[model samples]
Each structure stands twice: as C-alpha cells, then as structure tokens.
Target chain A: MSQIIKQEKKRSFVTAPTAALLSLLLPGLGQILARRVQRGLLMFGALVSIVGLLVWRITLLGRLAEGFWPTLFKSLDRAPMFVAFGLLAIAGLWLWIVIDAAKQTNPNRQFGNSIFVLILVVFFTIGWQISEIDLVKLSSDANEAWVPLSKILWPWEAAVTHDTDTVEAGAKVLVDSEGQAPPVPEKTEGEPYLRVSPRKGELSKLDEDNQVIPGTKITVYGENFEPNTRTQIWWSDSIGNEFRPRYQGEYVSVMTDSEGSFEKELIMPYRLIPPSAKGQQIHKVMARQVSQVGPPLPSQPLILTIELIIETIFMGMMATIFGIIFSVPISFLAARNLMSTSWLTLTIYYLTRTVLNIVRAIEPLIWALIAVVWVGLGPFAGIVALTIHSIAALGKLYSEAIEGINPGPIEAIQATGANKLQTIMYAVVPQMIPPFVSFTIYRWDINVRMSTVIGMVGGGGIGFLLVQYIRLLEYKSAGIAVWFIALTVAILDYVSAEIRQKFV
Target chain B: MLEIKNLTKIYPDGTLALDDVSFTVEDGEFLVVIGLSGSGKSTLLRCINRLIDPTKGQIIMDGQDITAAEPSELRRIRRKIGMIFQHFNLVDRSSVMTNVLSGKLGYINPWASLLHKYPPGAKKEAMAALEKVGITDQATKRADELSGGQRQRVGIARALMQNPSMMLADEPVASLDPVLAHTILGYLEQLNSESHISVICSLHYLDLVQRYATKVIGLRDGQVVYRGDREDIRKMTDGQFKEIYGEEAVRVNAGEFDQGEK
Candidate 1:
C-alpha cells in the first residue's frame, strides 16, 4: 500500500508543472489540467469577456488604429483557435507546478512553504499577463499617434496685434509716404522744399501753409543717412491731422543706426490751430530718412503682460498670514485638550467649522465677487475673500492637528500644577508643530492656485489675463497664460512638498 | 485625611456597581480593599476622588463636604487627591517628565499654564517625584517607549506630583507580572511609611494584601462582606469565603487554600 501511495504521489508531482504551463498559455487551462474543468472555463470566459469589452470600447471611440484592438483580438479574436492553444499551454504549465509541489517530501513541514511559493508564482504570472494585455492599443494607428502627440502639444500659441500710428517725439518712426498720407506736392515755385522730413506731429492741430504740420524737430540720424538728409521736409494743414509727407523728401523719414541713436531736422506743427470741431483728435506723423535701401524695421514684440498674477500671489500670502493669525486662537477652543467640558468651546468649534465649510464650499471667485460688493474691487476684495476662507479651512485643520497630540504630556503638564493654558503650550503645541506645518504648507499651495482662479471675478490674478484672452478669441495667448498658471502651480507643489518634508 | 460615608455607585445601565458602601480611612494607614474582579473594588476607590461620583453619598475630606461641591470645587479637591489607574493611564506620547508635571496643574491659573510658565519650584518638584519613582533618568523618554514596569512607576510619580493628602490606587499592580507587581506595592508601602500620606489601595492579589495592608476590607456584589484587621481576615471560615466568592469558588480553592498564602 505504501509503495502504491508513493507511485501516485510521483505521478501527480510530475503533472503539476505541465498544468501550470498550460494555464500560462491560456487562463483557466491549468484548472482544467488540474481536473477542475468548470473553474477553468469560468476563468477563461471572464478574461475573454473583459478583453472583448475593452476592444469594443476602444473601437467605438475610433482609437482602433492604435493597435489596442488588434492586440486584444490577437489575444482573443481567434476565439476557438487561441483559446484551445492557450488552454493547452496553461495546462502544461499547471501540471509542471503541481508535480513540483508534490515531489517535495518533508517531515518538518517545509513542503507547505514550497507549495505556497509555487502558487504565488503562478498567480503572479497570470496577473502580469492580464495587466499587460492591451486591447485598445492594438486597434488604431491614429489613436496610437495621437495619444503621444497630444502630450507633446499640451500648449498652443496664438498671435494678437493692434495698429497704432502715434509716435514718441524722441522715439524712432516708420514713414509711409504713399500709403494714407497727404496728396503729393506738385513742384510749383522754387521754394527750396524738403521732402519726408523727420518730424514730430502736433497734437490736434494743423500747420502753416495749409498743411497738417509736424512738431519739434528731433535729429533723426542713422548710419545710412547724410547730414543733409534732415533738411527736406513736408507738412499737412488738415485740422486735427498730424503732418504727412507731400513728397518723398529727405526729411520725410528717419532710420536709427546700429546703436539706435538718430538725428533729424523736423518741421514743428503749430499748436495755435483750432482742434477738431467735433471731438478730441490725435495728430500722427512719420519720420523717414532716405538711404540706398530702407533699413529693415524691427517687428513689434508681442506683449502679454498681466498684473493679475502679482495681485493673486500677494492676496494669497496676505490671506495665509491673516488666516494663521486669526485661526490659531480659534483652534484652541475647538481642541479637546484645552477645554474639555465647556459648552462655549463646543459651540465655537461647530460655529467656526460650519462657517469654514460654507466658505470653502463656495468657489473663491464667488467670494471675490461678494467681497467686491462689500469692500469694493481690487486686491482688498481678494484678500478679504481668501482670508475668510483660510480661517475656516486652517481652523479645522489646526484643531484636528491639535486633537491628534498625545494626551500624556497634557496630563503631565497638568500634574505639574500648570493650568489648562500652560498644559496646552508645553504639551499640545509641541506635538502639533509637525502636522500643522504640513497642513499650512499644503493650504498655501491650494491658495496659490485659488488666487489665480479668483482673478476671473476681478479678485486680481493671471486669471484675469486668461479670461481676456479667451474672450478675445486669442486662444494661443490664452494657452500661453494657461501654461504659466500650470507651471506656477506645479512649481509651487514641488516647493511646498520640499518645505513640508524639511520642516514638518 | 479622607472620609467616605454611605457612598453608593450605580452605573447608568442600572447595574449596581457599589451598594451603599461606607468606609473611613485614617491618615497614614495603608488600607488595602480586597475583592475578586467586579466586587466594587475600583468603584469604591474612585468614589474618594469623585472621579466616578457616588450616586448617594457624601465625601468629606479636610472638613469640606465634596459630594455637594461645584465643578470648580471638585476640581480643586481632585487636585489635592491623586488617583492612579490600573492601566497607568499615562498619556503614552508625552515624555515621562511632562506626565509627572501634570499633577501640579490645579495650582496654576489656566492662562498661565497655557504659557507653560510653571513656577520654577513645580519643575523641581516634578523631577523630584520622578526621582522618587526611580525613573528620573527616563524623564525625557516618551511614556509609551518605556517598559510596563516603568510606565507604572511614572503613574506613581504622577500621583505623587499632586502632593495630595491621600492617594487612591485602584488595582495599581493588577496588570503587572508578579515581580513587577510586588515592586510597585513596595513603593506604595514605602510612600505610606515615609510620608504618612493616607493610602487606600484596591487589590486582587491576597498575598500582597496580607503582606502590606494595615487594614483589610472585602466586598461581595457591591456590599462589604468583610472589614477589619488582617488578623480578623485570617480567621475567616470556609462559609464566609463562599459568601464572598460564591460556592463554586469554595470548591475550586478547597485544596488550593492549604498551600495558598493566608
């Protein structure tokens, strides 16, 4: 009988690994190899169903080209074909493990340990395959390319431009004589005339000679200009219209040298002329200097400056400071350590918590609006909103932190003839520092992000610029603004994390 | 130093934890109240400090009736009479020094205490108490970090920090092993001897009680079944032990008592 038992054990041991191998090739095949056909089919069916669902969803979303579908199908599409092949493989593997587990004989019971390890290995292998099988990625090339492309194209830019003709007297100018200027002069009498003179246009006035006149002469000089280039000039007499070149004269334009310094003689327009009879007007002018070829003008730099970001940072900092100052004392009332039986303390705790929850529940923008109504617009409103919200949020967190402190020290301090307040200072406060620092830093991070958001409602931040860009349909600039915000938030998160780790 | 008259405690669940029990402990006496588990041992001890207020009794300590005292007055009384628990009830996270200092809290103003400006003397006193318990070296260590024996010593130090006229130890060594248990009892005995501070200790170990107690009191189902000298206890008959511990207890101890410490 003992000989027969030994032979049976040997046979089972030999088959276990083969069964495990079969299961690895196809899920549940090991169970079938182990003579549990029902369980094997159940597992096989579940895996196929899940894979099918994933593939179907991926295809529905038009992500098939990413190979998500194909991978899943390859693993499952040839239902009968792959299933039979996979089942056979898994059955072989399972048989191997079982046989190995059975072959170990020990009077000391170490055989149980070996069997457990083998079982763990088999489960781990099955799990790995399930996780690695990518049905969606197998379906579509488009999705495959788009997924990675989307990450790289996270931010986009757009250009915005506005035209302006006003020029500062000493600043450089562009002279466009043929386009939108006074009619060209017909060389009438020999009044030695200057053409295209470097000139400053008088504000809301006409010049002598019935032509719109330029203002004070500022020497417009450049490397390419001759000393005589500033001599010839042109003027216009149209009221409220600045001087314009009647002819492409020497004084009509001025170009700066490599050092950006220029010298030019400009005809000053008379300011004594009546302004426009209808409304306020601005006189315009251009200074051009003739050269062998016109020097390339520099393109105007795109400016996307916003004061809202600065305002938000300031508001957030102020709010955090005020919040800390105001909330710390209130937190003591809520802490069970300091006041154990005072109903007044309990009331204060709930009241502060409720107010805080209400403040937090409403978005910061709404708070900004409310604050604006109460305190008026600008940083003051933002500060008030952030401070109010911070008090509630910081209060709750601080109280909980105070609560978690070990009671032993409090009791010890109490035993020392220290009163309630003394115990709190010596016992509770010391233990609370770590969590308090951590929570405060985290709150500041959130406040920074919130500061930007609150700017949309005029609370003052980069959000204002983002709103304007979005409204103006400058999505590219808006994208740039969004990038700034995201970058700021990420940096803050990292910095805060570092600070919390170091201090807390 | 302390008087407990007609003290009875009934839990809210309608269970009679202590039935109209009355006892008076003289100053400087090492009084050990012995009983099996759930025999009003702890309830009787807590009643002295009003930690667990007796339902129908008056505790007159130092000529003041505490049973009718206001919350503030009760707190004042509590400060003067320190109570130790079986679990040592030391805040586990606090340093040993801090736990000892808490006993002096009742003497300082709340706001002053909040600032941790314990009069310099209080600090010295706290350290002295720790020294008394022989755990002065562990003053900076967290209470939980200490061994069970050390933790209980801290508990004693905490009680001593109160500078009370009387100390109430409710099964102080019930949680310790035999050796640690004896060491703690020895400390309490030594404290009683040197300070002449009245002590009312509840205990389960009959051996310890017989060894250290000047007087013995036994309770059965919230009623005092035996009260008197240690000599009177030694003369108790099998019937009396049965009355206190029930008949099943008698049968189990019939043979064991022969070898058991009387």
Candidate 2:
C-alpha cells in the first residue's frame, strides 16, 4: 500500500495532474485522456443512462406539476424515498467517478469498479418503489380474490336444478270499496284451501315523497296442506301477474301445524291499477307449499355453456380448414428460398411477408370486431376472423418450414430432368408433409383458443355468454364457461401433441 | 464423343471457378479428374450436363451445343447424361423404388408423372436397375433407412434408370469409407465396361485414380495443370505431382491418406 501511494506521488506531474483535473469535470474524461477510450465511453454511457432514467421516472411521478423545477420538487414530495435514493446514487456515482479519474492516472494503483455496483443497487431499490411492488398487499388482499376464485374453481352447483311440485290455494280480495269483491270459493276435502278475512283493503301506495305506505292487514287461514311443511304466501294483481310479497324484509311464509291447518296475518302488497278499469280490481292471495320431486336437471346456464362451447370448437375447425387452403399457396410466395431466384419474385416475397405480418399483428378479437360488422354477429363471423388471422400465422410458419428443408433432394430431383412443377411435387412436397401436418394441427389449437375469446366482441361463442354472466354478477355461471374453455384448450393441446407425434 | 472448348465460369461474386478449361472424352473412355476442394472439379462435371450454365464456353456433344440449348432442349440432353453426387442426394422420405422410377421422368407424360402414374413397364425398369446395383430387395425401404454404402447403390440404381450415354460422378466416394469407395467405383466400372457408357468421374485418392482411370487430368486453381494416360499416371514424378498440387502438398502413403484435400 505504501509503495503504491509513493508511486502515485512520484507520477509525472504534467500529464497526471491534467488528466485528474479533466476527469474531475467529467466522469470519463480522465480515462479518455489516459487512452482508455472504450472504458471511458462505457462509463460515460452508464452514467448518462442511469441519470436519464431517474429523470424520466421523476417526470412521470410529477406529471401534474406546473414546470420543470416544480415537477422535480413535487415528485420528491410524492415519492420522497425514491427521489432521495436516486439523488444519493447520482451523488455517490459522481464522487466515485472523480476518485476513479484520479486513480486512472496512477500507474501503481489498481482500479476497482465496486462503486458502480453500489450505484446500481441504489437505483434498483428506487425502481422497486417506483413500480409500486407490494408483497404485503398480495397476501393481505388474497381473500378478495378467493371470493370469486372459489366460485370459479367449483361452479357445478349452479349448473343443476331440482324439479318441484306445488300445492296451492287462493282467495280473492278487493283493492278498494269503489268496486265489488269476488265471492269466496267453497272448501273441499283432500285439497289445500285458503280464506282471507275482511278481504276489502287498500293496496300499499306511494306517498307525496314516493315513500311506500303500509296497507291494511288481513288474516289468512289455510287447511289440508302437508303437515309441518313451510307454505309461502303469493299475491296476484288484477292482470294475473303473480309475485311473492315481502313482509318486514322477508318473504311471507308460515309452517303448517301437525293437523295441516294454520292461521296468519299479512299486510296488503302495493299494486298500481290503471284508471281505465271500470270494475273492482280483485287481487288473489295464495298459499303454496312446494316439494322437490325427481332428479336434478341441467340449468339454463349449463345448457347455454355447452351449446356455445360446441359452437366455439366448430368455429376453430372451420377456420383451420380455410386457413390451410389459403395459407398453403401464400406460403410458397413468402418462402425466400423459392422466391429469391428473380427480382420480381423477390418483390412478391417481400409483399407477401409484409402483408402476413400486418394481418398477424392484429389480435383475433380485433378481427372479430370487424367481422361482426361484416357478417352481423354469429359463429360465421368468428370463423372469418380466426381464418383471417390463421392464414397469416400459418403462412409465415409454413414458409419458414419450407426455408429449412434440405436442398440436396431438390438438386437431385432437378438433375433428373424433371420440370419445375414436377421437381416441387416429388422433392419439396414429400419433405414438407410432416411439418405441414404439424403446423396445421398447432394452428388448429391456436384457433380454438382464439375462438373462445373472439365471441366477447360479438362473434358468437362461449365468450359472449361468459361476458354477460360476468356483467350480471353471475360468477358461478361465468365459472362454467371458463372451465369449459380451459378444458377444451387442454384437450385440444393434448390431441395436437399426439397427432404431431404420430406424423412428425 | 464429347468436346469442351475454352469453358470459363465466373460467378456473380467475381469468383473464377473455371478458367478457360478445355478437355475431350471419346466413347468408352474412363476419364478421371483429380483436384483439391474448390479446384472446379465439380464445376467441370456439372458443365457437361448443363446443370451449371457456363459464363463462356462450348460443350459440344454429338454435334449439339449443350451450353446453348433452350430449357426444353437442355432437359432433353440432361436426361442422356447421368450424374451422381458425393452425398447420394436421394429423397430421404421417398421409397428407393420411387426415387429410382423418378429418373424416367424425362420420358413420361407431364400430367401422368404429376399424378405418379408411370408407364406400365417403368416399375420393371426400376427393379432391373436396382438389381444391377444388387439392392433390388431393399427397393421398398425409404432412402434414409439404408447404410451409407447401400444409399450410394440406390443412387447408382437411380442413375442407371436413365440409360444414359455417359455418367458424371462428382467425388462420389468422398463421403464413404475406403472399402466402400472401391465398392461404389466397382459398380461404376461394371456399368462402363458392360454397357460401353463413357464415365467421367472426379476422384481424390491417387491409387484409385491409377487403378480406374483410362485417362487423368489434374486441376489447380480452376486450371488444368497435368494430364496423363493410365501408365503415365502410375509413373508420375514428384515434380509433375507438385505441378498439379501446390509445392506444400505432400502425398501420404498409398491408399490410406487423402492428397490435397481441404
């Protein structure tokens, strides 16, 4: 160490002092003066890039600030920790570069880059804060995710329903004294019966503030119902529209006694009658007891899920068939090896490649949106969208496969005095079969996955139903669609793998 | 008979592949070409069949200028001249019988060949050619399934199906073992002697050149530097050998080592 310090002191005063002074002004200037051009440039570039990144981040954090200085200060106020560390890193780098510049002029001293690593660690920490990485929230908010995740994981309960048999009896009631009420029907044996006392009553009405006012209460008597069974009270308006009436925030229901008889009281429900009616509006009050019967059947969501999933699969199949038909020819035009023979053919190759790239760059959902307008929202539109995208994707893949083929057989075939078409048929076509089949199968797999998503843009598949269920807050039903898509994609992936293995 | 006059091929990249090369081969002559890699040996052989169009040359075969033939006429001449490669360029996925039958494509109807419906006797001809190379039983196997020697035999069979007037072998034995090299060359020799087919083949080893060549030409830097008859080749002096190969080139013992190989 002493020898190094003594050698550093003994260095030529003229060049060494000038080099150190130049490096103090700019971080890499001394190194450049020492003829370390590459190392100096690298140091300069790293310093500029890191400082530039820090400035960009600061600007992003304070975008709403008025001007440059205010924005910088405002960003510091908002993210003090990131800004503080960023400034500290810049200062540390500046000091380190100044020391390093002086050290570069000393022949006996070895330069160390450990300070650069320290600067990087400081900036990386600032980046973590700027990106808002929060592992605490990830675990803390997991319950919120699980609420829907559980529904998605197991949704079969909503997929089925039980058939039920109802035993019901009704009694008529008058809405007001302005019209006459219907007479009560005679009670019969071995059947349920309901009778309402003092049937003439006012229906619940909205007041001046539109707040609901409770109507008159009436006692209801029931008999011949199933013993110890719960019976619900339902009301029908003058037009025969039936709905369960809520009493005190709960549906009006009562349990029958052991003798199959009971009595209960319920306020009249609110109903608006049109002024055009000439006679009394007799609303019916009914007591109904329900019993589940037979096996569970598929619910509407389950049936719709199955139907749309099948449509999605067929859309993929049709798209793949159309893609294979169109892409096969286009691939020949796009293959560089085949088209590079002449400038005219080379132009066609570039044109085809550019068009394929443009078409493939657009997502299938975007194509589906355009196709929905063209074909008016059906599986055919989804097929058209997927086919358009598939053609571009498969064309590029097939052309690459063509480019990768062994040229030996092609030369051999040409030497046999075969025509151009005959050469392709015998030499290129045989070599292309395995790859063609593999790519086609792989494309079909992609098309199937894309078809499910295309339906969300009105292209007619399970995704349409899935979006509707999600918007309606039907998590279990959306779960069914998600499950179907996942299962179908997995199965198709396996099938394609098997087919590829068999052929390739 | 064949005649090549002042054949010169300059590639688009300005590579002088063949520089004013001139040679002649009469009927029933086994002419062997010896050279280092990139010495225009393959280029010279390919020029005879018009596979590589010469930049400037005259390839006169039976009073017809092959280099000046149109596409249709060139193909007609190419079918009469069979060529084999060092790599045995058979379609790996195709059956040996199919590969051999394809050699008759020049004579078959275009549409019929496209549909793979050859003339009735074409299969018989392919089998006969295969039998000539002693691989008729392996005709049903795919070309890639065969051993190196067997694949070369298949190549020979495919070439024989053309019934050509001459054969061009471009380093046909380079990729095979020394023993297999003699086996493949023996087949070419049998066809040459039995059918009077003029054979123009490029070879690497000096012993093989001396054993099979009725006449020999050596090339260096795409120019012919040495010519000798069978007896003259057997008695070639070191100075003559150095004239064809560079001064730094040393001939290793007998058939065990390659000479002037890259």
Q: Write the per-residue lDDT of candidate 2 for residues B1-262, one digit (tens) a residue.
A: 9998999988888999899999899998899998888999988998888678899989999889999899898878888888889999898888999999988887789899999999999999999999988888999998989999999889888888788899999999999888778788888888889899999999877778877899999988889888888899989876777667778666643353233121
- Candidate 1 chain A: worst 10 consecutive residues by lDDT? A169-178
Per-residue lDDT tens digits for candidate 2, residues A380-405, read: 99999999999999999999999999
Off by over 4 Å in 2: A1-136, A162-164, A176-181, A202-214, A226-229, A256-263, A270-279, A290-295, A342-344, A369-376, B237-239, B252-262
When summed lDDT is taken over every stretch of 10 residues in candidate 1 chain B, the lowest stretch is B253-262
Tens digit per residue, CA lDDT, model 1, A453-472: 78678776677777876677
- Superposed on the true interface residues, model 2 gives a C-alpha RMSD in angstroms of 0.9
Fnat measured on candidate 2: 0.59
Identify the candidate with maximal TM-score. Answer: 2
Please identify model 1 stretches exceeding 4 Å from their true place. A1-310, A321-360, A391-441, A469-504, B10-16, B33-43, B62-64, B68-79, B87-95, B107-112, B141-148, B173-179, B203-221, B225-262
- Report every candidate's CA lDDT: 0.64, 0.87
Model 2 CA lDDT for position B79: 84
lDDT score at residue B164, model 2, on the 0-100 scale:
88
